[model samples]
Target: MSPTPSPESMLPLLVDYIVAWVLICTILFLGAQRLKAKIQFYAMQSLGLSVLLGAIGLAHQNTKALILAVVAAIGKCIIIPLILRYVKRRVPMNKGVESYVAIPTTMLMGGGMIMAAHYLTNHLFYNQSHLFNEMLSTGMALVFIGMLVMMVRKKAFTQILGLYVVDNGIFCLTMATVFEMPMIIEMGILFELLLGVLVMGILVQRIHDSFQAVTLDELEQLKG
Candidate 1:
Protein backbone atom coordinates (compact mmCIF):
# COMPACT_ATOMS: atom_id res chain seq x y z
CA MET A 1 0.00 0.00 0.00
CA SER A 2 1.20 3.51 -0.72
CA PRO A 3 1.88 5.71 2.25
CA THR A 4 -0.57 8.57 2.77
CA PRO A 5 0.72 11.81 1.32
CA SER A 6 1.81 14.26 3.99
CA PRO A 7 0.12 17.64 4.34
CA GLU A 8 3.32 19.24 3.05
CA SER A 9 2.99 17.28 -0.15
CA MET A 10 -0.53 18.65 -0.63
CA LEU A 11 0.43 22.31 -0.20
CA PRO A 12 0.43 23.05 -3.88
CA LEU A 13 -3.10 21.74 -4.31
CA LEU A 14 -4.29 23.81 -1.40
CA VAL A 15 -2.62 26.95 -2.70
CA ASP A 16 -4.13 26.38 -6.13
CA TYR A 17 -7.61 26.05 -4.68
CA ILE A 18 -7.32 29.28 -2.71
CA VAL A 19 -5.81 31.15 -5.64
CA ALA A 20 -8.69 30.04 -7.86
CA TRP A 21 -11.25 31.23 -5.34
CA VAL A 22 -9.53 34.57 -5.01
CA LEU A 23 -9.74 35.05 -8.74
CA ILE A 24 -13.43 34.21 -8.69
CA CYS A 25 -13.98 36.77 -5.96
CA THR A 26 -12.16 39.36 -8.03
CA ILE A 27 -14.46 38.71 -10.96
CA LEU A 28 -17.53 38.91 -8.74
CA PHE A 29 -16.26 42.17 -7.36
CA LEU A 30 -16.05 43.60 -10.87
CA GLY A 31 -19.55 42.48 -11.79
CA ALA A 32 -21.24 43.57 -8.59
CA GLN A 33 -23.48 46.64 -8.88
CA ARG A 34 -24.20 47.67 -5.34
CA LEU A 35 -21.51 49.02 -3.04
CA LYS A 36 -22.49 46.63 -0.26
CA ALA A 37 -22.09 43.64 -2.53
CA LYS A 38 -18.62 44.77 -3.53
CA ILE A 39 -17.60 45.08 0.10
CA GLN A 40 -18.88 41.57 0.76
CA PHE A 41 -16.87 40.19 -2.13
CA TYR A 42 -13.74 41.91 -0.84
CA ALA A 43 -14.31 40.41 2.59
CA MET A 44 -14.75 36.97 1.08
CA GLN A 45 -11.57 37.41 -0.92
CA SER A 46 -9.68 38.41 2.22
CA LEU A 47 -11.01 35.36 4.08
CA GLY A 48 -9.85 33.14 1.24
CA LEU A 49 -6.39 34.71 1.38
CA SER A 50 -6.20 34.21 5.13
CA VAL A 51 -7.07 30.56 4.65
CA LEU A 52 -4.24 30.25 2.16
CA LEU A 53 -1.79 31.82 4.59
CA GLY A 54 -2.99 29.58 7.39
CA ALA A 55 -2.49 26.52 5.24
CA ILE A 56 1.04 27.62 4.46
CA GLY A 57 1.73 28.15 8.16
CA LEU A 58 0.42 24.70 9.06
CA ALA A 59 2.44 23.03 6.36
CA HIS A 60 5.63 24.85 7.33
CA GLN A 61 5.03 25.05 11.10
CA ASN A 62 5.49 28.81 10.87
CA THR A 63 3.96 30.68 13.79
CA LYS A 64 4.27 34.07 12.08
CA ALA A 65 2.15 32.94 9.16
CA LEU A 66 -0.49 31.63 11.57
CA ILE A 67 -0.59 34.89 13.50
CA LEU A 68 -0.69 36.97 10.35
CA ALA A 69 -3.57 34.86 9.11
CA VAL A 70 -5.49 35.62 12.29
CA VAL A 71 -4.77 39.32 11.94
CA ALA A 72 -5.89 39.33 8.32
CA ALA A 73 -9.10 37.52 9.14
CA ILE A 74 -9.98 39.95 11.89
CA GLY A 75 -8.85 43.10 10.14
CA LYS A 76 -9.85 42.50 6.55
CA CYS A 77 -12.74 40.06 6.79
CA ILE A 78 -14.47 41.25 9.95
CA ILE A 79 -13.63 44.76 11.04
CA ILE A 80 -13.29 46.30 7.60
CA PRO A 81 -16.54 44.83 6.36
CA LEU A 82 -18.39 45.90 9.45
CA ILE A 83 -17.12 49.43 9.11
CA LEU A 84 -18.07 49.54 5.43
CA ARG A 85 -21.52 48.20 6.26
CA TYR A 86 -22.03 51.04 8.72
CA VAL A 87 -21.02 53.56 6.08
CA LYS A 88 -23.31 51.91 3.58
CA ARG A 89 -26.25 52.23 5.89
CA ARG A 90 -25.64 55.93 6.36
CA VAL A 91 -25.15 56.73 2.66
CA PRO A 92 -28.02 57.14 0.22
CA MET A 93 -28.42 53.99 -1.87
CA ASN A 94 -30.92 55.07 -4.49
CA LYS A 95 -28.38 56.56 -6.84
CA GLY A 96 -27.02 54.25 -9.50
CA VAL A 97 -23.25 54.05 -10.10
CA GLU A 98 -22.54 53.74 -13.80
CA SER A 99 -19.32 52.15 -14.96
CA TYR A 100 -17.00 53.93 -17.34
CA VAL A 101 -16.75 50.76 -19.37
CA ALA A 102 -19.30 48.04 -20.02
CA ILE A 103 -19.09 44.83 -17.98
CA PRO A 104 -18.22 42.67 -20.98
CA THR A 105 -15.41 45.00 -22.01
CA THR A 106 -14.06 45.11 -18.48
CA MET A 107 -14.08 41.33 -18.30
CA LEU A 108 -12.20 41.11 -21.58
CA MET A 109 -9.65 43.56 -20.27
CA GLY A 110 -9.27 41.44 -17.16
CA GLY A 111 -8.53 38.37 -19.26
CA GLY A 112 -5.88 40.27 -21.16
CA MET A 113 -4.33 41.36 -17.85
CA ILE A 114 -4.19 37.74 -16.74
CA MET A 115 -2.37 36.79 -19.92
CA ALA A 116 0.08 39.60 -19.39
CA ALA A 117 0.66 38.49 -15.83
CA HIS A 118 1.38 34.96 -16.96
CA TYR A 119 3.91 36.17 -19.49
CA LEU A 120 5.59 38.46 -16.98
CA THR A 121 5.77 35.75 -14.33
CA ASN A 122 7.29 33.30 -16.79
CA HIS A 123 10.14 35.69 -17.55
CA LEU A 124 10.72 36.81 -13.96
CA PHE A 125 10.40 33.49 -12.18
CA TYR A 126 11.78 31.03 -14.69
CA ASN A 127 13.77 29.27 -11.99
CA GLN A 128 10.89 29.01 -9.51
CA SER A 129 8.55 26.10 -9.03
CA HIS A 130 5.54 25.89 -11.34
CA LEU A 131 3.17 26.40 -8.40
CA PHE A 132 5.03 29.51 -7.29
CA ASN A 133 4.84 30.99 -10.76
CA GLU A 134 1.13 30.27 -10.93
CA MET A 135 0.44 31.92 -7.58
CA LEU A 136 2.52 34.94 -8.40
CA SER A 137 0.80 35.39 -11.71
CA THR A 138 -2.59 35.12 -10.06
CA GLY A 139 -1.52 37.80 -7.61
CA MET A 140 -0.45 40.09 -10.42
CA ALA A 141 -3.73 39.51 -12.20
CA LEU A 142 -5.60 40.48 -9.07
CA VAL A 143 -3.64 43.71 -8.90
CA PHE A 144 -4.61 44.57 -12.44
CA ILE A 145 -8.23 43.65 -11.85
CA GLY A 146 -8.29 45.82 -8.76
CA MET A 147 -6.98 48.81 -10.68
CA LEU A 148 -9.60 48.17 -13.34
CA VAL A 149 -12.31 48.21 -10.71
CA MET A 150 -11.10 51.54 -9.44
CA MET A 151 -10.98 53.02 -12.90
CA VAL A 152 -14.36 51.75 -14.07
CA ARG A 153 -16.46 52.30 -10.97
CA LYS A 154 -17.72 55.81 -10.24
CA LYS A 155 -18.57 55.46 -6.57
CA ALA A 156 -16.07 56.38 -3.90
CA PHE A 157 -17.07 53.29 -1.93
CA THR A 158 -16.36 50.99 -4.83
CA GLN A 159 -13.05 52.73 -5.47
CA ILE A 160 -12.08 52.15 -1.84
CA LEU A 161 -12.98 48.51 -2.22
CA GLY A 162 -10.73 48.40 -5.28
CA LEU A 163 -7.86 49.69 -3.20
CA TYR A 164 -8.49 46.89 -0.74
CA VAL A 165 -8.42 44.46 -3.63
CA VAL A 166 -5.03 45.80 -4.69
CA ASP A 167 -3.75 45.41 -1.16
CA ASN A 168 -5.02 41.82 -1.10
CA GLY A 169 -3.08 41.07 -4.26
CA ILE A 170 0.11 42.38 -2.70
CA PHE A 171 -0.56 40.32 0.41
CA CYS A 172 -1.13 37.23 -1.71
CA LEU A 173 2.19 37.69 -3.46
CA THR A 174 4.15 38.26 -0.27
CA MET A 175 2.61 35.44 1.69
CA ALA A 176 2.77 32.89 -1.11
CA THR A 177 6.33 33.61 -2.19
CA VAL A 178 8.06 34.76 0.98
CA PHE A 179 6.14 32.95 3.66
CA GLU A 180 8.73 34.28 6.06
CA MET A 181 7.89 38.01 5.72
CA PRO A 182 8.75 39.66 9.04
CA MET A 183 5.85 40.01 11.40
CA ILE A 184 6.61 43.70 11.88
CA ILE A 185 6.41 44.38 8.16
CA GLU A 186 3.11 42.52 7.91
CA MET A 187 1.78 44.45 10.89
CA GLY A 188 2.86 47.73 9.32
CA ILE A 189 1.05 46.91 6.13
CA LEU A 190 -2.06 45.97 8.07
CA PHE A 191 -1.86 49.21 10.02
CA GLU A 192 -1.60 51.22 6.83
CA LEU A 193 -4.58 49.42 5.34
CA LEU A 194 -6.67 49.95 8.44
CA LEU A 195 -5.71 53.59 8.63
CA GLY A 196 -6.43 54.17 4.98
CA VAL A 197 -9.85 52.58 5.27
CA LEU A 198 -10.78 54.66 8.27
CA VAL A 199 -9.65 57.88 6.65
CA MET A 200 -11.43 57.04 3.42
CA GLY A 201 -14.59 56.19 5.27
CA ILE A 202 -14.55 59.61 6.85
CA LEU A 203 -13.91 61.26 3.50
CA VAL A 204 -16.74 59.31 1.92
CA GLN A 205 -19.15 60.40 4.59
CA ARG A 206 -18.15 64.02 4.11
CA ILE A 207 -18.55 63.76 0.35
CA HIS A 208 -22.01 62.32 0.69
CA ASP A 209 -22.98 65.03 3.11
CA SER A 210 -21.56 67.85 1.04
CA PHE A 211 -22.43 66.87 -2.51
CA GLN A 212 -25.43 64.63 -1.83
CA ALA A 213 -23.60 62.11 -3.99
CA VAL A 214 -20.58 59.87 -3.47
CA THR A 215 -19.76 59.29 -7.11
CA LEU A 216 -16.33 60.26 -8.38
CA ASP A 217 -17.85 62.29 -11.19
CA GLU A 218 -19.42 64.57 -8.60
CA LEU A 219 -16.13 64.91 -6.76
CA GLU A 220 -14.32 65.76 -9.95
CA GLN A 221 -16.50 68.85 -10.37
CA LEU A 222 -14.87 70.21 -7.25
CA LYS A 223 -11.50 70.39 -9.03
CA GLY A 224 -12.35 73.79 -10.55
Candidate 2:
Protein backbone atom coordinates (compact mmCIF):
# COMPACT_ATOMS: atom_id res chain seq x y z
CA MET A 1 0.00 0.00 0.00
CA SER A 2 1.12 3.51 -0.72
CA PRO A 3 1.97 5.58 2.35
CA THR A 4 -0.12 8.61 3.23
CA PRO A 5 1.44 11.99 2.49
CA SER A 6 2.30 13.95 5.59
CA PRO A 7 1.60 17.70 5.75
CA GLU A 8 5.25 18.35 6.55
CA SER A 9 6.29 16.55 3.40
CA MET A 10 3.51 18.19 1.35
CA LEU A 11 4.00 21.78 2.49
CA PRO A 12 6.85 22.49 0.11
CA LEU A 13 4.91 21.20 -2.85
CA LEU A 14 1.94 23.33 -1.95
CA VAL A 15 4.08 26.43 -1.56
CA ASP A 16 5.83 25.81 -4.86
CA TYR A 17 2.52 25.34 -6.64
CA ILE A 18 1.12 28.57 -5.24
CA VAL A 19 4.27 30.40 -6.22
CA ALA A 20 3.95 29.04 -9.73
CA TRP A 21 0.38 30.31 -9.90
CA VAL A 22 1.51 33.75 -8.80
CA LEU A 23 4.17 33.79 -11.52
CA ILE A 24 1.67 32.61 -14.11
CA CYS A 25 -0.72 35.38 -13.17
CA THR A 26 2.02 37.94 -13.71
CA ILE A 27 2.68 36.48 -17.17
CA LEU A 28 -1.04 36.68 -17.96
CA PHE A 29 -1.05 40.29 -16.81
CA LEU A 30 1.80 40.97 -19.24
CA GLY A 31 -0.29 39.81 -22.20
CA ALA A 32 -3.64 41.20 -21.07
CA GLN A 33 -4.83 43.79 -23.64
CA ARG A 34 -7.68 45.29 -21.65
CA LEU A 35 -7.46 47.37 -18.49
CA LYS A 36 -10.11 45.28 -16.74
CA ALA A 37 -8.38 42.05 -17.67
CA LYS A 38 -5.11 43.36 -16.33
CA ILE A 39 -6.66 44.38 -13.04
CA GLN A 40 -8.29 40.99 -12.66
CA PHE A 41 -5.03 39.19 -13.25
CA TYR A 42 -3.23 41.41 -10.77
CA ALA A 43 -5.86 40.68 -8.15
CA MET A 44 -5.56 36.99 -8.81
CA GLN A 45 -1.82 37.21 -8.46
CA SER A 46 -2.11 39.04 -5.16
CA LEU A 47 -4.64 36.52 -3.95
CA GLY A 48 -2.24 33.72 -4.70
CA LEU A 49 0.38 35.39 -2.58
CA SER A 50 -2.10 35.91 0.22
CA VAL A 51 -3.10 32.28 0.10
CA LEU A 52 0.50 31.13 0.20
CA LEU A 53 1.18 33.26 3.21
CA GLY A 54 -1.91 31.96 4.93
CA ALA A 55 -1.00 28.38 4.21
CA ILE A 56 2.47 28.88 5.59
CA GLY A 57 1.06 30.51 8.68
CA LEU A 58 -1.33 27.66 9.30
CA ALA A 59 1.30 25.03 8.79
CA HIS A 60 3.81 26.69 11.09
CA GLN A 61 1.43 28.35 13.58
CA ASN A 62 2.78 31.77 12.77
CA THR A 63 0.38 34.52 13.76
CA LYS A 64 2.30 37.23 11.96
CA ALA A 65 2.06 35.52 8.60
CA LEU A 66 -1.62 34.87 9.16
CA ILE A 67 -2.26 38.51 9.94
CA LEU A 68 -0.30 39.61 6.93
CA ALA A 69 -2.37 37.29 4.78
CA VAL A 70 -5.55 38.94 5.96
CA VAL A 71 -4.09 42.37 5.43
CA ALA A 72 -2.94 41.42 1.95
CA ALA A 73 -6.39 40.12 1.09
CA ILE A 74 -8.01 43.32 2.29
CA GLY A 75 -5.53 45.66 0.73
CA LYS A 76 -4.08 44.05 -2.36
CA CYS A 77 -6.97 41.80 -3.36
CA ILE A 78 -9.93 44.04 -2.58
CA ILE A 79 -9.05 47.67 -1.92
CA ILE A 80 -6.44 48.03 -4.62
CA PRO A 81 -8.63 46.61 -7.36
CA LEU A 82 -11.57 48.75 -6.26
CA ILE A 83 -9.45 51.86 -6.34
CA LEU A 84 -8.21 50.91 -9.82
CA ARG A 85 -11.71 50.26 -11.12
CA TYR A 86 -12.87 53.58 -9.72
CA VAL A 87 -9.99 55.31 -11.41
CA LYS A 88 -10.82 53.52 -14.61
CA ARG A 89 -14.38 54.83 -14.49
CA ARG A 90 -13.29 58.36 -13.61
CA VAL A 91 -10.70 58.57 -16.38
CA PRO A 92 -11.57 58.57 -20.03
CA MET A 93 -9.27 55.93 -21.52
CA ASN A 94 -9.20 53.52 -24.40
CA LYS A 95 -10.66 50.07 -23.87
CA GLY A 96 -7.71 48.39 -25.52
CA VAL A 97 -4.32 48.64 -23.81
CA GLU A 98 -1.51 50.06 -25.92
CA SER A 99 2.04 48.77 -25.68
CA TYR A 100 5.25 49.74 -27.42
CA VAL A 101 6.01 46.07 -27.97
CA ALA A 102 3.84 43.32 -29.36
CA ILE A 103 2.09 40.97 -26.92
CA PRO A 104 3.90 37.86 -28.10
CA THR A 105 7.27 39.53 -27.82
CA THR A 106 6.49 40.78 -24.34
CA MET A 107 5.40 37.32 -23.27
CA LEU A 108 8.59 35.80 -24.68
CA MET A 109 10.65 38.31 -22.77
CA GLY A 110 8.73 37.49 -19.59
CA GLY A 111 9.36 33.78 -20.08
CA GLY A 112 13.06 34.36 -20.63
CA MET A 113 13.24 36.44 -17.50
CA ILE A 114 11.49 33.71 -15.51
CA MET A 115 14.04 31.20 -16.72
CA ALA A 116 16.87 33.53 -15.82
CA ALA A 117 15.39 34.11 -12.38
CA HIS A 118 15.14 30.39 -11.71
CA TYR A 119 18.69 29.84 -12.91
CA LEU A 120 20.13 32.58 -10.73
CA THR A 121 18.14 31.57 -7.67
CA ASN A 122 19.13 27.92 -8.04
CA HIS A 123 22.80 28.76 -8.34
CA LEU A 124 22.83 31.16 -5.41
CA PHE A 125 20.37 29.34 -3.17
CA TYR A 126 20.83 25.69 -3.86
CA ASN A 127 21.25 24.99 -0.17
CA GLN A 128 18.32 27.11 0.97
CA SER A 129 14.88 25.74 1.79
CA HIS A 130 12.70 24.85 -1.18
CA LEU A 131 10.19 27.46 -0.12
CA PHE A 132 12.89 30.09 -0.08
CA ASN A 133 14.13 29.22 -3.52
CA GLU A 134 10.63 29.19 -5.01
CA MET A 135 9.68 32.53 -3.52
CA LEU A 136 12.96 34.17 -4.42
CA SER A 137 12.84 33.04 -8.02
CA THR A 138 9.22 34.19 -8.41
CA GLY A 139 10.08 37.45 -6.71
CA MET A 140 12.92 38.21 -9.11
CA ALA A 141 10.84 37.25 -12.12
CA LEU A 142 8.00 39.47 -10.96
CA VAL A 143 10.34 42.41 -10.58
CA PHE A 144 11.85 41.89 -14.01
CA ILE A 145 8.54 41.46 -15.79
CA GLY A 146 6.97 44.36 -13.94
CA MET A 147 9.74 46.69 -15.04
CA LEU A 148 9.40 45.44 -18.57
CA VAL A 149 5.66 46.10 -18.52
CA MET A 150 6.18 49.58 -17.16
CA MET A 151 8.64 50.43 -19.89
CA VAL A 152 6.62 48.97 -22.75
CA ARG A 153 3.14 50.19 -21.83
CA LYS A 154 2.09 53.62 -23.04
CA LYS A 155 -0.53 54.58 -20.44
CA ALA A 156 0.21 56.11 -17.07
CA PHE A 157 -2.40 53.89 -15.42
CA THR A 158 -0.79 50.80 -16.85
CA GLN A 159 2.53 52.00 -15.57
CA ILE A 160 1.07 52.34 -12.10
CA LEU A 161 -0.15 48.76 -12.29
CA GLY A 162 3.35 47.74 -13.26
CA LEU A 163 4.63 49.49 -10.17
CA TYR A 164 2.21 47.47 -8.08
CA VAL A 165 3.59 44.36 -9.70
CA VAL A 166 7.04 45.44 -8.59
CA ASP A 167 5.69 45.97 -5.09
CA ASN A 168 4.39 42.41 -5.10
CA GLY A 169 7.81 41.22 -6.16
CA ILE A 170 9.43 43.01 -3.25
CA PHE A 171 6.87 41.51 -0.89
CA CYS A 172 7.66 38.04 -2.18
CA LEU A 173 11.35 38.63 -1.55
CA THR A 174 10.57 39.71 1.99
CA MET A 175 8.58 36.56 2.55
CA ALA A 176 11.40 34.38 1.33
CA THR A 177 14.11 36.00 3.43
CA VAL A 178 12.28 37.39 6.44
CA PHE A 179 10.13 34.52 7.51
CA GLU A 180 9.90 35.86 11.06
CA MET A 181 9.26 39.47 10.19
CA PRO A 182 7.41 41.61 12.74
CA MET A 183 3.78 42.52 12.29
CA ILE A 184 4.38 46.24 12.68
CA ILE A 185 6.82 46.29 9.80
CA GLU A 186 4.52 44.24 7.61
CA MET A 187 1.55 46.48 8.34
CA GLY A 188 3.63 49.54 7.62
CA ILE A 189 4.67 48.18 4.27
CA LEU A 190 1.07 47.43 3.36
CA PHE A 191 -0.01 50.90 4.43
CA GLU A 192 2.72 52.49 2.39
CA LEU A 193 1.76 50.54 -0.70
CA LEU A 194 -1.89 51.57 -0.26
CA LEU A 195 -0.96 55.20 0.14
CA GLY A 196 1.34 55.16 -2.84
CA VAL A 197 -1.33 53.72 -5.07
CA LEU A 198 -3.87 56.24 -3.84
CA VAL A 199 -1.51 59.12 -4.50
CA MET A 200 -0.59 57.83 -7.97
CA GLY A 201 -4.23 57.36 -8.90
CA ILE A 202 -5.00 60.96 -8.01
CA LEU A 203 -1.94 62.25 -9.84
CA VAL A 204 -2.71 60.25 -12.96
CA GLN A 205 -6.32 61.41 -12.96
CA ARG A 206 -5.29 65.03 -12.61
CA ILE A 207 -2.72 64.71 -15.39
CA HIS A 208 -5.31 63.15 -17.66
CA ASP A 209 -7.97 65.74 -16.81
CA SER A 210 -5.74 68.73 -17.36
CA PHE A 211 -3.85 67.49 -20.39
CA GLN A 212 -6.64 65.35 -21.85
CA ALA A 213 -4.23 62.46 -22.29
CA VAL A 214 -3.04 59.46 -20.29
CA THR A 215 -0.40 57.86 -22.48
CA LEU A 216 3.27 58.50 -21.73
CA ASP A 217 3.81 59.77 -25.29
CA GLU A 218 1.00 62.27 -24.82
CA LEU A 219 2.15 63.32 -21.37
CA GLU A 220 5.55 64.13 -22.87
CA GLN A 221 4.01 67.41 -24.02
CA LEU A 222 4.56 68.56 -20.42
CA LYS A 223 8.25 68.89 -21.27
CA GLY A 224 9.04 72.56 -21.29
Q: How much is the lDDT of residue 196 in candidate 2?
A: 67
For model 1, residues 47-143, the per-residue Cα lDDT tens digits are 9989988887888798878898898889889988887777666665544446889877887888788889999999988998877797789889988
lDDT of 2 at 215: 60
Q: What is the C-alpha lDDT of each candidate?
A: 0.78, 0.84
List the pairs of residues colliding in candidate 2.
Answer: none
Top candidate, metric lDDT = 2
Give a tens-digit lDDT track for model 2, residues 1-224. Answer: 99988967898989988988998898899989899999999999999988987898898788878998898888889988987887787766687889999998999999999999999999998998888889999989999988998899998789888888888887788777656656644654875567566656686766567565456556686773
lDDT of 2: 0.84
- The top-ranked prediction according to TM-score is 2
Q: On a 0 to 1 TM-score scale, where does candidate 1 land against the true structure?
A: 0.82
